[model samples]
Target: LETVGYTLVVNPKTCVVCMDRPREVAFELCGHFVCCAPCANSLGHGVTPARCPLCRADASHQRVMRRAASLHVATMADDHMHPPPPPPPRPPPPPLPRPPPLRPRARTTSLGPTPPPLPPPRP
Candidate 1:
């Protein structure tokens, strides 16, 4: 939430993936904050593997982001002792549309012998 006098908010750091939020979640292996916690949780979600956005290193130990008192941090976790609960699981993604059946190629029959290829001209 912005303050009463805060007309505009500009983040000094940005996630490479979202290009919006501050780069908060740092990967211990690469020592880079490729994205924030939400984005990191999002990247860590599902079967897909999470990797550092900058160096492409396999993100092992996710580190907490520490900012100066002046720097504004997004999300309730930054403020409250207990972070907000994860939103209800989203409905399973719609099933992928089945691909159309392939049609067999038509066969061509020639009664006469094929013509020979033309010779290339010398440069």
Candidate 2:
């Protein structure tokens, strides 16, 4: 957008206040268009007084501009926004093997199995 006498050229996409982010705000005090959201919120909602960038006036409330203001914003691509897709899911682990079953001892007719003949009474 060009004015009659002078032209205020900006990178469009850059924040008017910080010149980093895309134009995301518009201070209502002065007709300065498109500052980033952080700057807008800080100026408007912050504890300190609001100050307009273009003119040194009170810019308390700012309008958040959306992507619809594409023309006024620079056309810089943010590749970091998108990340590679996650890896595919892995197969389930194999089932564990089962242990053998225990068995009970057999009983004998002699008393305590004859105590193994007592070693011939130790001679």
lDDT scores of the candidates, listed in order: 0.62, 0.59
lDDT, residue 74, candidate 2: 23
lDDT (Cα, 0-100) at 101 in candidate 1? 100
Candidate 1 global lDDT: 0.62
lDDT of candidate 1 over 21-105, digit per residue (tens): 7777766665565577777777646776877666656775787776554244323322322322356798999999999999999
RMSD for each model, in Å, please? 17.9, 18.9
Question: What does the lDDT come to for candidate 2?
Answer: 0.59
User: Which regions of candidate 1 deviate over 4 angstroms?
Assistant: 1-12, 69-123
What is residue 3's positional error in candidate 2, in angstroms? Answer: 25
Each prediction's total of clashing residue pairs, residues at least 3 apart in sequence or on different chains, is 0, 4
Per-residue lDDT of 1-123 in model 2, one digit per residue for the tens?
Answer: 345567766565566677677666655545455567787776645466887665545677667757676434223222112222355799999999898888897977766534545555665
Off by over 4 Å in 2: 1-10, 44-47, 69-123
Highest TM-score among the candidates is held by which one?
Answer: 1
TM-score for all predictions? 0.43, 0.41
